[model samples]
Target: MGRAGPAGAAQESSLRLACVWEEPPAMGTCFGLPCDVDSRDEDSSQTLFFHPSTYGSKIRLYESCQVAERIDSFHDGIIFTSRPIHLHERVTLKILKKEGPWHGGLRVGFTSMDPLEIDASLLPPFACPNLVLQGRTWAAVLPDVCGEEDTVLTFWVDHRGRVFFGRQQGVQDILLLKGVPVRAPLWAIVDVYGHTKAVQLLDPTRLCGDAGEPAPPLSPFQSDVLHAPACREFHGRPQGCTEPCVICFSHETSALLHPCGHASFCYCCAQKVFRRSGLCPLCRGQIQNISQARLGT
Candidate 1:
């Protein structure tokens, strides 16, 4: 060419650079070959000098450049744009960074699905779906045999989404009694977690009704049991002694109220006594509930 223009010169420079960067190594190239200027050596030198075809193909370089440009454009959201992810698509998020103290780390954002929704379709097939039966308790279809009837049963779903079911008696309650009929709506089921199973039994007619009267006040005896003595004595003696007495007090001042009725014990003693017999340790009376009895200061 007599004189190349600026545009042609720039294109030539780019082609040279691409060829240098993308060319493959020559085949049959020997390392440490002596060049003593013999006939064979002269012949090889001539071959190397005149073999312009040995530069391989320059078109491959252009192809590689084109491919690299396409990749870069795709990564920058220019060539291939991404579609929005749908909610139904199962997504997982990992925590790359967190805020707040170690004891209570406040999660700022999750790398995957953070706050998941509690929905029926999201639950497992074997999972006992969460059902609110009465009060603040939550019920689930029993995964196992609870009792004679399996219509409404108690089941627990842990934080990790594991399902468990049983008739833990003192530990759990039946959703429906033998003679009683549960008239709860299907939509009342709220929580699927295992913490509190008490369901808020609602009546559609009483949706706008006035607040009901407060529960009846406890009797003095019931109040005494409610504020029962500690389970253990100050000296560590068991409060229930040998019998499961209702009003047994521990030395530590912590009270233990029997689950069934007006039975009480100290915290230390009650802990020991309740282990063997959940019932009223002394009177053989059935314990309906067990709780820490608080004495009036």
Candidate 2:
């Protein structure tokens, strides 16, 4: 948990977040949608170093979803991309907010070397082989998609190199990884997961245990765990059910289009996709609202 490079150095708080991870907010045209990108500064603290919490509330819904305060780690923690993405072209990333109190996590996408020493937040979750869990979200053509709430993670890379992923965990839209490999000079991977335990080192139950005990519920990285189990002795190649309704195939959808993160749709084609073009018919991206998910009784 100590990599530091881009002059970061700032780590103290096993857990404490109302907001305090400053520096990196000159972002306009984003949520406003339609800018290119300039102002340079890259360093990902070597791998993962995001702490955002200077007590937020510019009243954000997603002025465009750009969360970067710092991370250039000599250029590997890669962050920010309002433009410059070609190959199979198709980009999207949004998870604004959800599940706080710090369990913190990170592991976003895109990286084609050029100084990316590959430390995907300490990769170990199955050594990469494409993907398989979309409920808790974590399936990639081989890059791994994940979420706790407030999700979205679309990418593209077809012509034949095959790298397609569509995120959103709990209620569907899990098209996790499809061809895997557009590996080029591509960069922009927003990693930020959870973790910050130290409530008095979690009182050993209260002096040796249990005294009306409670503290035990951080909740956030769900998919349970079972990654990288194929371990090809010297080989490769190996590896969805109940999912229909990209807008009527006979019903069975639940709805979820909020912020351009497709959850498929069913409520009469999600109002017939906003009467036709609130955008997001797959990447038109621009649909401020349309949610309704929850059906797992």
lDDT of 1: 0.23
| Location of the lowest summed lDDT over 10 successive residues in candidate 1 | 73-82
Residue 161, model 2: lDDT of 40
Cα deviation in Å at residue 99, candidate 2?
A: 9.0
lDDT of 2 by residue, 174-267 (tens): 3323332332234333333331101011111222224323233324431111121112222111212334344333465566665545554466
Off by over 4 Å in 1: 1-253, 256-259
Choose the strongest candidate by TM-score. 2
Give the 10-residue window scoring lowest on summed lDDT in candidate 2: 52-61
lDDT digits (tens) for residues 106-133 of candidate 1: 0000011111112212322111111111
Q: What global local distance difference test value does model 2 have?
A: 0.32
Model 2 TM-score?
0.21
